[model samples]
Target: MPFWRHPSPSLQPLSLLLLLGTLPLLCSAATPGQLPAKRIQPLPASNLGSGRVETKGPGLYELTAERRAALETIRYAEGTWKGGSSIGYRILYGGGTFNSFERHPDTVVVKRYASAAAGAYQFLPGTWEAATRSLGLSGFGPASQDQAALHLIERRGALAELDRGVLTDQAINRLAQEWASFPTASGGSAYGQPSKSVEQLRAFHRESLRRHQLRREGAPA
Candidate 1:
């Protein structure tokens, strides 16, 4: 069963704004005193398969090479990653874990901090609800999560730049407001928590892009 029903169109914008505004205080990738988790290994190529993702609005968004790499880069910074393993989709906030994908884990992890964030993109319950409604997405599977994350990037107005393989400072800054793990232009977390440096994210993005390009060219990644 879907955990969220579609919100009325009339109320969507205001509701989404309120939910997103709380992200900075509620969505830190790691709690205080802990560094973001490092990637254990690369995800299998099978995990990178492309799919057609539909939006509530007109036009379709395919998971293209550059978009996939950009999504992976965001995953890398978000600490929910374990080499892009499926386990990342089961992670709860504050190092806890869950086993279901029927819905957002909605488990408020309390340790150094408390948050209901879960999955590869660390979506809070409200944020996830908003995303599902906005993108007409269902389930909490890896594919759905990826679509939702991309929807977020699109909403932040950074998806075009990312698709162009240009992760400009402006794009990163726009995204930083939504994902605390991404650093702002001034190289700091919007929430004042630890964040990945722009250089680090750029390096990861470059490597990911290279791998995707190689795969596209039918060569070894």
Candidate 2:
């Protein structure tokens, strides 16, 4: 079954609740003879927490340090960061790479579940189209994916809370509806699929914040 259906009330359609026992291995595996895509390197330690906000298309939003860390936490939960690389940007629904970022690689991969979800955020085609149109994003590259995910967070009304460095249970609960990987208040996958624990998410976010602070202070990450 498809991961999402169109004309849903939410910014993203509900995801397919498929058995994901092998999802981790699928996420890290590349297709035969397909070279891994170049990774989008992390910002230098000196650049973290420099108070420099990256403006998304037409300055629609600023990616502050807290917000960036929150996004990274989402990526972590989504199983998109393969071996510390941004190969997730080129990842298809189940696993495997797409050649171009000129647009969402709307290829539905059929494993235990079928989905056109792609990119680091696993945006379905409909979601990606909506985000790109809303944000004037022209590509499916790393910056565009980040901005798109932020837009979804904003749609869920959690952006302000995230910016305040308050990744509270309430905020996470609100975001859970958008990303299946995020646990709900009860610490289960909102979609009845695999998910990370709320405790794990909180811990990851805290460590990410600490690492950013360390970078800002010229300490080792």
The candidate maximizing TM-score is: 1
**Model 2: how large is the Cα RMSD against the reference?**
10.2
Residue-by-residue lDDT tens digits, candidate 1, 37-102: 222222222333335543344533568889989888888888866886878778887767888777
- lDDT tens digits, residues 97-193, model 2? 8998777877867666545678888887767766666666666778778876887887787888998876798888888878878877887766666
Q: Give the clashing pairs for model 2.
A: none
lDDT of 2: 0.66
lDDT winner among the candidates?
1
Global lDDT of model 1: 0.70
Off by over 4 Å in 2: 1-59
Q: Estimate TM-scores for all models.
A: 0.76, 0.73
Q: Which 10-residue window in model 1 sums to the lowest lDDT?
A: 31-40
